[model samples]
Target: MHAIPVSQSLPETLDPNIFSSPSSPKVGSEPQGHITEQVQTIWNPYKNRYRVLASCILSFANGMNDSAPGALIASLERDYNIAYGTVSIIFVCNALGFIAAAFFISTLSTRIGRAKSLMISEALLMIGYTAIVTTPPFGVVAASFFVTGVGMAMNLAICQVFCANLANNTALVGAYQGAYGIGGIFGPLIATALVSRGSKWSRFYIIELCLAALNFGIAPRTFWKYEQESKSLLPQPASEQQDRERGTVKRNDRTKRQWQSFKTLMSNKPTVLGALFIFAYQGSEVAISGWIISFLVQFRHGDPSKVGFVTSGFWAGITLGRFTLSFLAHRIGERTFVFFVTVGALILELLIWFVPSIPGDSVAVAFSGLLLGPVYPCAVHVFQRLIPRKMQISSLSLIGSVGSSGGAVAPFMTGMLAQHVGTFVLHPICIGLFVCMGISWFLLPKAERRDE
Candidate 1:
């Protein structure tokens, strides 16, 4: 099979310096002087596998950070002597971090290269973890989450871009995200167990601190060579094309070129649709996960201890769908499969909304998670296929970070609305979001290329 050309989808007027560092490298930049000049040699099997493993770790860390926030709320409020309303600021701060990262990470990735960007992110994460473990003032702890949020956004975007650019099969993407699902399953269990069993709640971050340290070690080794492997960085493989791009844009004007590309991508049909699609999808997913327990207890009069275990079932279903269905969707058709999955999830959500049976609602909740799980990775697969390689890192990051804010925003919105009405509204809100998801999917332009 022939490799898909990275520059094929890139605009002809694209700047050569978009992914290239200046000739005068910064003091800490990875040495790129020995980059090879062979076109075919860019594909290194061993290095490809190494990058995939690094992406898996990145995803796991994403899950580790995201899954614990809900579990920590009571602990954070009680231990820190903060009000419940004040503790909610943690989510607000984290969401702000994601939105802020979207605007800057593109420039950061372009200026330093993806490898160095991730290293900085890891360092930031370590700092955030260390601060959080101290159980400092509530405000300080909330601020620490914003620091961690920036780190996760950078890593998440960079890794998604790196893996997507590798142009490997969608199954690899499935497995990468599937690792996050596994981590999500484990994170809540461990966090809740330790807190409930007399362990200090803040101690959970010590485990994450250790994980961040491990990521710090793994990231540089796997990604430092990205400048050498990623095709768009230099024109060495196509010396003639290099000469042409050089003639069109000057070195000092590269930032202008980057912004131009960003504007074009922002206006593109697929990119816009992709963002809204993920916004609704993430909202649907997080709302259910965050509110299921309250919905079960408040509306259906279920036992808190008994119904809490149902969240495990929900997460388990998600993990299974991500690992299994994401791969299966690739074989069938990502777009078609996703449309049907949303429909199935819609059906289950209605069951939870209308039926008063706790056991029935519990089963519906798990099935809803099962169906919702594959949507994220599958949408990613679609985004990589539709968005040009040149814009994907920025666009995917925009989608990832902006879309992730939905996880926080949607649940928070549900909680506020539920206060006036009731927990029963969770299912209806999710259903409305899923319907928006369907519309977004319908509006998305068909992929010019689909992985077969």
Candidate 2:
């Protein structure tokens, strides 16, 4: 039998399914088969710009929330008359919230859609900030952080999946993560200024509350009907359509599928390694952001007012790196770029550890932030390519949310150790975590070049 010619159409008399085989393309299916190849680029002016903008706004607020703890920790301890170990409960609660969100975010996104999920996240952040601003008991404040963490995790998982799938993903991911760095910069600055000026540490959340309120409106407006728009922009795969048409699917199965996705995510080598890499990366980042000030104040005897600015410096460097150095990741190849930066960060961390002077240590901390900054976006870009596309959202949610628990675990450990050993413990912990990052980075499977 002769092969069917591309120029010829299938006969009207014959059923198209008769020509279809598992190993062969079905008659008249070539154009439809190529639908999966179509993708949305960041340059789409009709809608993606607005979506990206909304994501950035959400990220900026998250940065402010995460970094503020560093600037406010001292004041919190003073006001509550709590020791380092006690003040660190906020990190534990925040991590618990993130871990809890990891379990439900995928389901929430599926059931309610991205827009409503994001709006709910913003609402949670607002509530958390409101609780903090009231300057309630330390336990209540810690619980408030748990609420914020749940909200932040939801936004992070959704935005990351969206940004990672766009064209020019590395650059876009960099820009997205860069927004977080910018927020981190201002978080400490505002918090420090407010505290130094005789205002309460909790007063800083007033700014965060305002930002969350803005995002609450922006998220729904920008992301409303997002799933429909995305389907229109990038048509669904035939497999996905088939899955939908199965009609046997029920709302109850969503939970089953989510658990299966988690299990599948854990079994993938790249996913597991990626999670570990983020675990180390964020662990070090938050440890430095949360503890560097105490180190400076204790070891160098630096003034609390002036030294508090160091956290802002560190975040500024992170912002600069994510924006500027991230361009190099695409050129150098994301995998190679990550190795160089991780090594650079480790060296700088050691310097921060041993350096005797406040000025030198502060500069090292900033440069360390600069080196560590692009690692996240770059790693995320690589993970997107390595993981199967269908699993990307749940995989990234696991990688981001569960992995980000390191931000809490590491800092909580640092706070506890600082109470016993002194703030100097931060440098060694950070250095060790950097080494873990290196190892995890090395273990990650190489991402193959994706077809356009």
Candidate 3:
């Protein structure tokens, strides 16, 4: 694709520098009088394939990290002699970790470059995994997840920014997310296999440790020169002296301007609505992935070994749906497609709740994942269309951070509620989240048709 000229129509009140570094502007940043060059796509420069490969590996690790909980929760409860509410503390801590990382990830990436930021993220994952694999006290185990949450949040934010800036961004983002689903598929499969075969629950994280170590070794090498590439790719309008002065100004007032931009984003209807949509979307998605195995075991009276694989089925559906259905989202219209799928997922959720049979619930759960898989990418596509290009990075960063918290908050709530009422509460909570998604989708501003 030909590089498009940067639009000069950005509002004076917004700060383009807030969403990017002093030297490297984000994909749509408009520096005065200069055109923004597009980032290299996988095909345009074959070297980017290495970067994409690394990102997929990172995402796959994340998928395994997130999905393994459902399969292992039973083992954790059994081994630790903890109740559902007590065991759910890990989810709460993990959420806090993600929230903590979200606030710093942008600034961290800016100050240290993407390469170092990703390395630190991997390091954090290694720390978390190391702590977990030792089968320390339950409190220690929970705290370790917080570290992993921080790591995963940083990795996700940076990789997403990279993919979103690529040519054929939608396709790249889909593949990136699909890798997560593939990891999701394997995570439960591996965890379930290990636990069911008389291994301790904590032993499962050894595999995660190895995965994190692999990424840690690869990340710096693959992304070490990323910022230099970005600087070269983005056209510089100002001379060296002017650029130095601009950089100084960015350093002096970066935090203040970023705060102001964040305030502006909060008040924007489309951004708020978009965040809410994704929040509900991920809440429903994670709630299912994290709790469905427990639900099957408790409600269906299915064996833990057998029911554990149901989570894998759900993630497998997500993987397949992301790969297959995401292609159709544009043709069907994202807004309309999301509405249909939300309704479809809600119906399947109802079937899962009402139909007590394990076989029937398992099928419903997988199909629900299939319908839900494409919503995230499609929502992002609509956001790209609706939000101003200059503010897309910050807007999306905020949206993703908030949405990830939903993943934590909803499951935490489910775990707590399940302690008193039973695991059946998962269905109602997910159903309600779907309703929230539909409402948020309804409230979002219409996406105007525009050329990329």
Candidate 4:
């Protein structure tokens, strides 16, 4: 793509020294001119494309890591001679680690640049995966997974925030998030196929580590180049400028403002509602994705290889749905699209629950993916538009953390249900959950204005 030139509209009187350290702008200075110029430059159509690609790479990594454990759960249980309940504890630990990191590590990213935060996350992922591959004790394995979760939380929070900032037109945020869903579709299929062959699960992590490292290496050059070109296009401060030399004061103020912005985001009803949508959607998706193998093998007497294909079909449906909706959402409107998708998902889940035979069950599960795919991306698009630009990261982080928690909760619940009520009944409960989510989406107040 051709590079879009930065806007040349910055105020003439701004001190040249401001360009020296883009990291720390002077405190107590009005940022009107700087903010405007930066928005104009960074919001170019070309920059959004790069950001979308980067976001996709991050999503691909997320998929590989997220899908690996569930796919390999039976193997781990067999190797360790552990009960299903005991095995499920691994996911609990992973979720706890993600929750902790999302609350704390995500805040740190604002202080250090988003790029630096992502680099650190990738490095930690490498270390965590290495620990897992070493065949440590169960306790050690749990710790390694926990660390991986931490890295994942940071990576997810930063990438979502980065994508929001890069969006030029409000209508395209769904398209950007759709790229993430596309990654989710492929990551698990590839990971599961590798694990099924008796290949070491650690190899999957190693591959992901290499991909993340490459992304880290290449992103900075492009991001910085974009930053420089866009700098002149940013708005200048409207308030009197502080002395450019006082770096400490500027840093302190920025930190304070970020915290305050976080508070405001937490207080907003629309933000909370948007997060609930993510939480519900992810819970439904993970519950089905994580347990489908077990359901087929234990309840239907299906082979593992066939089970993997069945699960993969679901993901394939999701990928196709996301790719199509990325462009289609612009024409249909997000609210209407979300309502339609959720209702369809609800219907599909019910079909999966009621179907008695393998053919019918498989078809329902695969079709569910298409119906459920657009819910997440559209919800994210809504939240991004509702919240202010500066608060986008904190808002996305908070919602993402909640959403990840849902991912954890659903699988854990399914495992428990499988242990008690019998594996065959889990599908019905999932159908119920989708119905509730669809009802909620339908009832959610429509956006009062297009640009809100």
Better of 1 and 4 by TM-score: 1
lDDT of 3: 0.80
TM-score of each: 0.82, 0.88, 0.92, 0.81
Residue 247 shift from truth in candidate 4, angstroms:
7.3
Name the regions of candidate 3 deviating beyond 4 angstroms: 1-32, 44-46, 239-243, 246-256
Model 4 stretches astray by more than 4 angstroms: 1-52, 168-179, 224-232, 240-263, 388-392, 450-452
Off by over 4 Å in 1: 1-45, 77-86, 231-256, 300-306, 388-390, 448-452
Best candidate (score: TM-score): 3
Candidate 3 lDDT over 1-452, as tens digits, reads 00011111212222242222221335554566655555467764555788888988989988988888999999899899998988888877887787787556765676688789889999999999999989999999999989988888888877766777777778888899999999999999999999989999899899999999999999767888776765666544566337667666564465576566667777888889988888888888888988998998888899998989999999999888889998898898999999999999999999999998999999999999899888888888888877876677777776777787788789989999999999999999999999999999999888765543
Cα lDDT computed for each candidate against the true fold: 0.70, 0.77, 0.80, 0.62
lDDT of 1 at 292: 77
The residue-by-residue lDDT of candidate 1 on 1-452, one tens digit each, is 00011112233222333332121223433235334222211145357677788888878877767776655655665687754345556766776777667666756765687778888989999999999898788788889988988888778766655554443445566677777777777766777777767777889899899988898889877877666544543444355457557796466576565567767877877878887888788777766766676677778887554565566667778889987887788789989999999999999998888898998987887787788889887887677677764465456655665577776677777767766787677778888988999999998888764323
Local accuracy of candidate 2 as per-residue lDDT tens digits, 1-452 = 00000100111111122211111223333555444234566666367788898888888888888888898889998999988899988888988887777556655666788899889999999999999999999989989999988888778767766776666666667777888889999999888888899998889999999999999998778878877766565554566467778866576675565456556667989878877888888888888999899888888899889999999999999999989888888788989989898889889888887879898989988998888878777776677678765555455656776466788889999999999999889988988998898898898877666544
Better of 2 and 4 by lDDT: 2
lDDT: the better of candidates 1 and 3: 3
Superposition error at 409 for model 4 (Å): 1.1
Please name the candidate that would achieve the greatest lDDT relative to the true structure.
3
Residue 258, candidate 1: C-alpha displacement in angstroms: 3.6
